[model samples]
Target: MVTLASMEPLLPDSSRELEDLAIELTSVASRFAARLHPIMRASVGDLVRSMNCYYSNLIEGHNTLPIDIDRAMAGDFAREPEKRNLQLEARAHIEVQQLIDRGEMPYPVLSLDGICWLHGEFCRRLPDDLLLVRNPDTGEEIIMVPGQLRTRHVKVGEHIAPEPEMIEPLLARFAEAYSFKMLSKLQKIVGVGASHHRLAWIHPFFDGNGRVSRLFSHALLRDLGIGSGLWSVSRGLARNVSDYKRLLSQADQPRRGDLDGRGNLTEAGLAEFTAFFLSCCLDQVTFMEELLKPEELLNRVEVWCNEEVQMQRLPKGSWPLLREAILTGEFARSQAQALTGYQERQARTVLSSLLDCGVLTSPSSKGKVRLGFPVDIIERWLPRLYPAVR
Candidate 1:
């Protein structure tokens, strides 16, 4: 019974409040992206990707620790089968996101092809054990095909998704309605949230719809030039998970009489979800901005480095070189002596200590050194990013 018309009101009403949020998010995200050094941005982006994967997976009831994720990135898998599968799942999410971050996708993320790509790319990387989905009512074991639309009906909670036959046309309408090239910048921002709910409602795939929807939203923001991968709404959503799920379900409600606008679904509900989505994004950007504030960040690093030096874990004068890297993003190895006010040999010794501890990194033996975010230092360097590795 579902038709293309059933997915009407692709966007919520452009109330002043919604417009204000869109404008504010655009401004804040731009300022945050502009503030970081290119090298710093890259380092931060890497860490945020892991954080995004962690939080995104957490939302799906998978609890892969931050350290395990780091280990997975290093190609070190857990010994237990279940744990290893989750690690691979986490790795797959990060790899697919990296492609989106690097703009390697051939299709626009809002397009049907793009959504399938996200699903296929992520799922294809996953282990065979994770591909099977069990039907709750029938106890039928369904093997999910990567990138392929579901051939059977499915239900998520109380909501029955659109028929499998309706998915293609629904997604086609979706891509055209929220096309990035068509919407105004502010509208695109709003559409990121609106499209997010619609995609989840459609549930195009047999599994991995939640992950695909999130990845889609992330890519949409990046495409809009607002998300630099330095901040993610995943963390915010995970933190407020109850409200996040509640809002998603709320947005699925049908129209509430004539006041809810002309749509099969509720416009007021859609608007509410969009506003919550944008607010989460703005809050995350603001949180990261404060965490990366030069003075505060450097102070925290210096305090940690000084403690390590006193404890004889790091060589004396280690703070200065770290300070230099943070300030300049990266520095020549030869400048280490002058930066630390130490003799050449002593400076080299200090640099080696940092590299050995994984607090600094270089492309080659003699390449410029940039700040590194090893798991051990992440808690000190970027506290509250995730639970400390234990």
Candidate 2:
């Protein structure tokens, strides 16, 4: 197993740019988590409802952007879902679940090979022969099989891939780093992200490097105590697909005079990439802040009811119940009846009217209702999602 002690930070400009970016991103996350009203303030039902709300919006986003490969990686591939990617993620999710469940400390499962396949585990078993190299049309080099249709209309360019003889020696030098055990939260996560990026820059395998990079990112979050379950960084990265590519290229691009993209890559690109990546994470923090912002929902309700209160009679004595139902996550007509201190028929009318007004929307299903698309105000805002305390 490779160990981190034997490895050095891939992008360490004496300028300390990467560290600064990491600190900024992490600080925003901590501040956001700290500022939010205690989740306990909301009932367990509300928390569950909140997730559903966010998920529904994320799904909608995915559907609208069908070809966005990165979004698909985030577990939002319901639109043109791939069975193989689903299976790999399922396997990766489950395996990590086992590690977390075991309460394993100084997690030993962070092996290099496992980390790679864990990201693209679905194709890990594919024969090496299938790992043919092809330049996509985008002028950027990408690896895929001969028969597979190029989904992205990629502009293939001259192969700028690295040789294994070169990579193997590099790996041998850091074999200990590949399987190194990470003990601390910050070190482990920072390490994981850096490691994944480095591996991709190397273009180690003929196939699945992108998938592997994503999987490693997801696993690192788990190891770092971000979320209780697998994270959806793939989705986050997918959302900024262009930035991700540009940053990766920038990080790997030859610093100067090395047109072949050989020699030590520049620190500026990685620093920018890491900073942007962290910014992406803070984006998620902002999203959580919105969900946890009690006033967000209340503000919507106030806006909806203000006019009704001004122009019309307050729905025949059902104001109180309607207010409580929307403020809380109550969707059932019967629940509204009790909350409103009104007749059952009156309560139903009030609740249905609120839904119609879009103050309290729910999915098509019954017995389950909550604030619906008010969720999307933060959907595209989703960053890496829970790097801690999911």
Candidate 3:
């Protein structure tokens, strides 16, 4: 039976390699923010939230296409029962994530209460079909109880979970080790990577453990201020699911030898997994940074706007206001006519056209217009961010 004490050296030592990774992560995060204005950042954050949900669901083997997710968000559900349940699951994931990003749930992310709440909240909103899990060998069915720890033994593949009574105590120790006060900023970032595997290793829940662990890590990154909601670690993990699962399983191995670490779990394996996890994070941040570079992003928008204008989907001179909004993040509602360089009536035509097409969005009719990255337009505005959907 694995216990908290058995997971020795919960984090790797501060070595040159770890330091380099920490520095690069910080640098990339700073650079990513510098690439976009605040309003654009918010817009990108919303896009990323949608993408995050897509990749997260993808990792769960539910290929609810990104277009389908958008449709579901707009109140459209699939006719097929399984696909519809998957859509609801994706929506639930995004909703929970929005709450986390807003800091609405205040529990310490690594704490037992936090994990339980995360699981309960996510599972509570899931569809009825998703609430049932079957044992592969015995065909035994289990009904999941939201917000409640398991009272029976469970095995996830070759790994057996700790005794049901041991769950709370192990989680308490987890909180103590990964708590904010206990780690430096860099260590905390590293902690996020480490705890991701450790939590999954714990397999605290019967059904939603993987999703809960991903969300838990996401909340940790969000709290660390590096997450920013502008990009996600899930995308990288899902893209590299084979290596991710392999690394996670390897990290579950027993200590290799006397030099590994002073715990029952292998420090070398944990360190290797952390390195891969952080690399995934760094890769995601770098991808978004390259994708959002002002010059490249503007060019894409310009090309799209030009095509739309030629096709009469938008009024003439609409590109100027759209470009201004994209470059400056947002533009005043009053300056619409001036920015479009057109008569009042003509400018309103452009603005209204853009708004109707979701090229622009505002809080209300009288509010400032902000750039919008609608899913249908993602192919042109932001390519390869998520799988292109029809």
Model 3 lDDT tens row, 1-390: 666677667887667777678779888887887768989888888888888888888888888888888888888999999889988998888888988988988687878899999998899989988999888878899888887888778877777878888888888888889884867888988888889998988788888888898889889888887855888989999999999999999988888998988888888889989998989999999999999888888899999889988987788888888888878888887788898778888888888888988889999998999998777888888888876667
Candidate maximizing lDDT:
1
lDDT of each: 0.91, 0.46, 0.85
Per-residue accuracy of model 1 over 128-213 as CA lDDT, tens digit each: 88999999899999888899998999899978899999999999999989984666888988999999899999999999999999
TM-score of model 3 vs. true structure: 0.96
Which runs in model 3 stand beyond 4 Å of their true positions? 180-182
Better of 1 and 3 by lDDT: 1
Q: Relative to the unseen true structure, what is the C-alpha lDDT of residue 352 in candidate 3, on a scale of 0 to 100? A: 88
Candidate 3 lowest-lDDT run of ten: 1-10
Provide TM-scores for the models: 0.98, 0.53, 0.96
| Superior by lDDT: candidate 2 or candidate 3 | 3
Question: Could you tell me the TM-score of candidate 2?
Answer: 0.53
Task: State in Å the error of residue 374, model 3.
Answer: 1.4
Cα deviation of 259, candidate 3, in Å: 2.1
Between 2 and 3, whose TM-score is larger? 3
Tell me the tens digit of each residue's lDDT in model 2 across 1-390. 223222234533323544554555566556654553332223322332233222322322322222222233334444333534443334333343344334542333355445433434334433343344455443455555422322332221322554444555444443355445543344444455556667665555554556545545545554455541212344456567678777767765545553322335555555567666655655654555565455665564555556566777346444554456545555565687777677778777777766664445565646544543233222222222322222
